[model samples]
Target chain A: MKPACKSCTKEHEKTNYLHMKQQIIEILTELRPEFDFTQDVDFIEAGMLDSFDVIMLVNTLDEKLGISIDGMDVVPENFSSAEKIEALLKKNGVK
Target chain B: MSLKFTYHNKRICGILTVLPQREVLFEEEMDNYNFSPAKSMKLKLAMGFNKHRIVDENTNVSDLAVFGINYLLNNQLIKKEDISALILVTQSPEHFLPATSNIIQGKADLGTDMLCMDINQGCGGFVIGLMQAYSLLEQQEIKKVLLINADVLSHKVSKRDRNSYPLVGDAACLTVVERSETPETIHAVVNMDGRGASAIQIPAGGFKMPGTPETAEVKEDENGNFRSLENLVMKGDEVFNFVQTKVPPMIEELLKIAGKTTDEIDYYFFHQPNKFMLNKLADKIGVPREKMPSNVVENFGNASGATIPTAVSFNLGDVALTHSYEVCFSGFGIGLTWAAIVQKLEKLKFNEIIYY
Candidate 1:
């Protein structure tokens, strides 16, 4: 019974992660609707996001998830993909 | 760490800014780079940049500064002898050997007893220049100091460098600081980090990497702007992060040190980088947009050291001279440097932007 409960908790956490990713996608789309976030994981590399866009994303994440991103976290590596952004959010105690 | 300083005896009496008459619209100029109209429109709308002033190739920062100083002297707004020290704050000097201030002294024909020096600074130069002027008053018998903040950044940027060229304007400002007996004090906070020095720099033309044939060879950057290492290059993301993360806290600390809150201040003048960045900063600091003038870059482009004085002279115009103001001035960039000054200005005789 304990093993089953652990499995259920793991599934729940996976669902939560998916929800956060969806929220991030929504934020990116709202900012620059012309780009497809799914296809372009290299958003930072492709020059899809300018400095203003990054600031807006940071502001939105703070407003939505109650997380503060610092200068260190603003690196292109952390913002290159939705998955990486989610990892950053988790590292900042978003969960 | 932050350095805090207070000055009780010095005050700025007047400010005059001069700009080149020639202008270039970004949309029209971007055609050479093949920057799409849609993208151009987006940048214009988002950055608040439409047109910028550019000087003729032959003109330098000294030409503009001399013109402004002569105007002040000729109009009898400030007498030549009243200036005990002349400070030229700029990175783009007329010559590397004789400091631009000394040459300007010769052209302005000031007395030999006067002190003249050029400070190699940009961006937050006005605040730094003002700080130096205040300190001089404390030491010497100086009664009035002529502070000239000027830069011709257009000459520093390459024509093919769309990222920087379109946003640079050429201008110079002359401000007169005199010893005053008023109780008003100037409060300043300054901070610097060499870690971010390379973020905005001309990689060559200095002693460390003297300009060579290869340095002048133009190559296209990933962003498509073509420029050599000899020209100015800015890591926009790093600068943006620095301004957003570091500057607001500095301003907050400055207000705390001054024993004033954001609301008590009448206007917050900033070194104009762009409308978007300034708006974001205002939101972060909770200063009202009305009090923050972010359009300096939009109308006149970023004149580096002269941005603040240019903003004041153009935005406030003569109205700044008519009333007592609790003004907060901040300049951040290029040295990866940021400085803020909070002071009170009473009636002033001159405040205007002149076109050359």
Candidate 2:
């Protein structure tokens, strides 16, 4: 069984997605170790994250940290930067 | 009573067409570029449409439609025969009244014995037009239907609408639908939400929101222009959610109905909007990297209804139609609409089929 979502523990609006950047970085590095997430460049625009990689990213977010990601949540604003992804997860109540 | 149904009968018989931003030919200075600051920074959160050409200040919606019709009629040996019907789908029309279809019918010389009309559908207009053509062909009496889709959203798009600047590029697209010797049945389903209608919509210029001095003059942004984002404000996040929520599932249901899976599909041609949105949809559906079609946004901008066929035509060589076995086409956005259909491409090259 999947663990309870950490995001569900807090208000959807008040959660801090920015705080999860490091964790996201670490997970991404593990998934695609060659990915140098340290760049200020946008992962998607830079051609690093294609559709295949994005699903892996979303799938991991759902598995490790416990967040409910919806389809609309995948836009560039949310997933382009690590900070944005963190914020989206927090919005979903990711602790 | 039940009839034995078939999913593979109708094939994408002839050829598909795609026009880049060069076609619309915008005359306004505001139509020059996607001024969004995020684009340079790579934060292209919204779709970025560089410069679009709808009709150089000289031409209008009608002119663009006729261009496509001439191409279609000239190619086939239909013998100046009366078309069974003509459907023009557009958000941009010349006058406030008569259908754009009339102009196309007049230009194509398709006889009056045909049914001619316009459908005011948004982005999904092209696909819907194809379905209508499908219906007419099913009757057996109608043999060919010409579907023309054109839009000059720049008319409504304010110059300074930074967010929507990249969101819209003016253009027109036309597809000649015919009863295939092996016609593509175009089994399809269209979904929409009037509530979400306001998500990506214009506030004036139509029946519901007539244009007024106040509505027209208001500067939506610091740039003092109005386009899709300003005149037609899109709750970017919300609209994204709407498509994300609706499109993937719809594609799944479509594939299920067709009794096929991702592995069986040769290609999934989507309306090129943005890399982010395309990647998101492709990810959600588990579509393989190779099976996915071209994302023409980097070049054509978003030609509204034209993107699907454009992608089909753009990636023709990559998929190697014969080897892939089948290709699927889908379109989303605008009308808050979404649709998908499966097709098998005949082994004819575009040059061989269209003779272009």
Candidate 3:
């Protein structure tokens, strides 16, 4: 087995990040279909998401993407929107 | 910390619960929480909460417990003299001075010779009360222990607070535990993390933070729930995370100590916070929906200390009285406490839910 070159590994990581964002959007939409995930960036402030919804989203991400979310990381901003959740995953080294 | 042990002689002989006559539907309270019709439906679907039974303002914890205990005595399921020890577990008691157990014992005329005490506990009250009762029974002199778990939390929460109001219902349960000639195996595991104490608590109205005129002034939270500092506040996300991550492993540890598997257990009665949370926990723990019930929250709301017994009464009340079962009970929340107990019940008389 040969190790992947640094450039190739970086390219794969970038692709993985994009895939995680798309998957996160899908999860949010499925969990609460009434809300438009693309337009609703301020989920908490807009009342589009409640505590129960956040928990479902957390479990879904862990189940679908294998992203282990610590209880401390379940803040308002991290779960505020699809883009924020994607960034949170990247910050936690999801890939 | 985690404590694991067994009770050899004590066995639950009978169980009874009392609920208030009043019922509150979610749709009626939509305006209180500023919830739209779609949002209300979403909450109902996700949380399995549509209606809750709450006691009126005048009713207190002692009222419900006494009513249930009187029913048990009147039906001849238990005699007043046969009760060797009385333990009342609740966060809401009749008075802060005299132990509520003493008051109940006095009201029931059980005599002062019987041991009576009160414990401050919340959602995990049933298992903890059972443990306490079994400990008293282990002393050998106590032949029968009456463990009363009650919480009239409806009085403590603000009706305007959707997070707390729709989730809490007032109720009380009296479980008669007696000494068995043949030792029955009962396994209990209690785990506590004080760091999460503030997750679900009343910030004021306690010895540490006594209530004042200022505390009585109602204020609206960011979520639109009107409450005072003395009222109950719950950080839902913290609690959900705690249960999802901590409870399943604790239950597995309980099964391991009992030298049994989930397959052997006949029923799993967990503290019913809501449908979504319970279903998620059932999936994480690998217990089927049939085995673990999620309707107590919908039917009775989260009655804190009384939740597990209420769950038992709602699901298995009729059949449990006539049949034998290998039962597992788990409760978590408030004190950031979580506990599980696995035991066997043989033809215990389970009475119907009384409306007081």
Indicate which candidate wins on DockQ: 2
- Model 2, clash count? 21
What 10-residue stretch in candidate 2 chain B is worst by lDDT?
B347-356
After superposing candidate 1, which stretches have Cα over 4 Å from the reference? A1-35, A40-42, A46-79, A82-95
In candidate 1 chain B, where is summed lDDT lowest over 10 consecutive residues? B32-41
Write the residue-wise lDDT of candidate 3 on B181-236 in tens digits. Answer: 66679999999889999999999987988889999889987766799998999988
True contacts kept of each: 0.12, 0.35, 0.08
In order, how many clashes per candidate? 0, 21, 0
The residue-by-residue lDDT of candidate 2 on B281-354, one tens digit each, is: 77678886456654555545565776666566666643444543576677777767777766665553331112
Question: Which ranges of candidate 2 are over 4 A from the true structure?
Answer: A1-70, A75-95, B1-9, B16-41, B44-54, B75-78, B181-186, B221-230, B317-325, B347-356
lDDT of 3 at B165: 87
lDDT of 2 by residue, A1-95 (tens): 44367666454424444346678888767655667997887887776664435655766676687544666676665677777777788676676
Q: Give me the TM-scores of chain B across the candidates.
A: 0.98, 0.82, 0.97
